[model samples]
Target: MNYVLYAVPFFFLLIGLELLADRWRKVSTYRLADAINSLSAGVLSTTVGLLTKVVGLLTYTFAWQHWGVFELSAQNLWVWLFAFVFYDFCYYWNHRLGHERNVLWAAHSVHHQSEEYNLSTALRQTSTGWIFGWVFYLPMALVGVPPLVFLTVAALNLLYQFWVHTRHIPKLGWFEWVFISPSNHRVHHAQNAVYMDRNYGGVFIVWDRLFGTFQEELDEEPVVFGVTTPLASWNPLWANLQFYVVLWRDAVLAESWWDKLRIWFMRTGWRPADVAAKYPQSKADLSQFVKFHVPLRPAQQLYAGLQFVLYVAAGSFLLATGANQSVAVLLGSCAWMAFGLYVLGLWLENRPQALGLEVLRLLLNAPALWLAEQAGLLPISTLGWSLLGLYSLASALALVLVARRGSAALPA
Candidate 1:
């Protein structure tokens, strides 16, 4: 039923409402570059999922068809009730192992990279989780839960998680004891020594409590967000690849074959003794932690924001119609969207070459739009093309004016 797809507008609406709350409360919880980068990772993840989701879906369905122990009917209310709770039990392990193991953490770390914990941070998902995440949910399939029920509960579980990513909600006393709440989930996102690797349940905190992974949010120790190893850039592609690259290099540097082979499957931060001794990695000083930032003028910020809106609109269109698209057209559109996001990341970083790269992006709009129309990905009318042309021209002119303002202006 594409429940997550249908919830997209509401997700953004809540994010907007959160911004208003931030204003009224006189507390800032979002940074423009960080929020955009988080959203970029999310957009990339969903777009990539359109291609990779068959892995998880097919494997689960296969397991259900061949190894069913009980015949569960979707029409039964008990089946829905049981599947909802059971899925969260499975998710607890899927999420817990994702933090406890190396290869899994490499994929799950994208969600934790955002220092500012907000609704946008919830959207910062991994594109590569399909590599091994399907194995965790086979128990539900084996127990004969219908695939339709499994899908619905999974969406509901995820949808239930969205509101818990905010700071506005305080501890809900008794409710905090059983179900996942903002307070406990905030502890889950914290990287402090006390908070690390705790509270992994998706909908029910009961699983964490039963499994001994629960940690209450303490008033004495304020939560410090983000991971120990900070993602020091705004690049979405790099955010997904960061930990994997670290693990690969460590594996290559190890002298022992066993260490090299086992490093990937080992605990989250386990490194070979030889590699650790020879090339020591410095621990982050939590007291000195600073969020990643880059300077931009007001005009430049506005330009970046407007261009991002265009990409969001295009990406939304692709997701809604991707099933009917030819493989070539889908792949082409995905590639273009990724390339555009990478360039936007550079703009956010305020790279010296950002101006030139943006100019190149603006110039490419004409041929890119024409190619998309020819591929039947976009059935744009003359008016649509004209509007897009005007957008590109205005963007190019905006870029020129911003560059002319020089680097001496105050930062955004």
Candidate 2:
């Protein structure tokens, strides 16, 4: 069973409740664009995972079948318990190394790009983590944890980490010592000098306490969320690729062949001496930090939000049905979703060409839906097609009205 898929509605419900809590506390933690961008990255991650997950599953299955010393039964309660703890143990190192190494951090940085600490920020995940993430859990497979048990515990471990992303939760007295709480996790997300690479556990705080990476949230030094190199754009695609792009450029520019190869696996933030001298990178001052933002009119914000709702609906359908789809269908669906999201990011940035791209997207959607139906990838009734038509028309009309009202002026 796909627990993450089933938990989708509940996640949104908690996000809504968090919003209410923010209101009650008289604090503003959710920004429309930032929240939407965070969720968009999440949706993209899940959508891309649908296509890439086979790599991890197949690798795990191969390892277990080939090298298992014991055949663990899922029915055993103790097996489940052990797997849960062991998964967190593996996750601690995976997460710690992700922050410590340059290439690993390239894929992991998406989660920290959000300046706001909220439920939505929790969903900001990497689409490319599968490239190296599977290696972390091989110990579980070697120890003969059943695949089903391993998957269930992995999902539960992830779900447990979601609630810790909020700012509303205060530090628990004793619980903070053993388990990850919002306060400690906030330190993990902070860019402050004291908090930069600390608190790398997912569910258990003991890992950090034992490994010497733990840092307490200090009253004198409040946590400032986001990376040292601010992701200045709201683009979800760019968010995932920004660090990789930086590394790629550095690798290309490095004069020494050894530095070119080592630049990727070297310590996080390490640059070749030659590249550093030629193309200096500036670090933000933690004491005087400012968030990256692009101004948008109210109408533009509303339009972007409404369009995101439709994307969510489409993404939910894909997640629920993707397992049963053929490779072609899954890839096609992912590509379409990714394009739509990229276009949405452009719209949020108020790009001059966004309106034209949106029109193209709407026009292309009719054929895309029709093709999916014909390919038997999606079930489309007459009403479904009618609704699609109506939605496209409505969105186009909204774009026109927003543009004519001079609210969505193209960025100069």
Residue-wise C-alpha lDDT for candidate 2, range 1-412, written one tens digit per residue: 9999899999999999999998999999999999999999999999899999999999999899999889999999999999999999999999999999999999999999999999999999999999999999999999999899989999999999999999998889899999999999999999998898999999999999999999999999888999999998889999999999999999999999999999999999999998999999888777778888888889999999999998898889888988888889888988898899999999999889999998998898999999899889778999999999899889988989998876535465
lDDT of each: 0.90, 0.93
Q: Every model's Cα RMSD, please?
A: 1.9, 1.6
Cα misplacement distance, residue 149 of candidate 1 (Å): 1.4
Which TM-score value belongs to model 1? 0.97
Q: Measured by TM-score, how close is model 2 to the native structure?
A: 0.98
Question: Can you give the TM-score per candidate against the true fold?
Answer: 0.97, 0.98
User: Mind giving the per-residue lDDT tens digits that candidate 1 earns over 237-272?
Assistant: 999999999999999999999999999999999999
Which run of 10 residues does model 1 get worst, by summed lDDT? 403-412
Return the clash pairs for model 1, or none: none
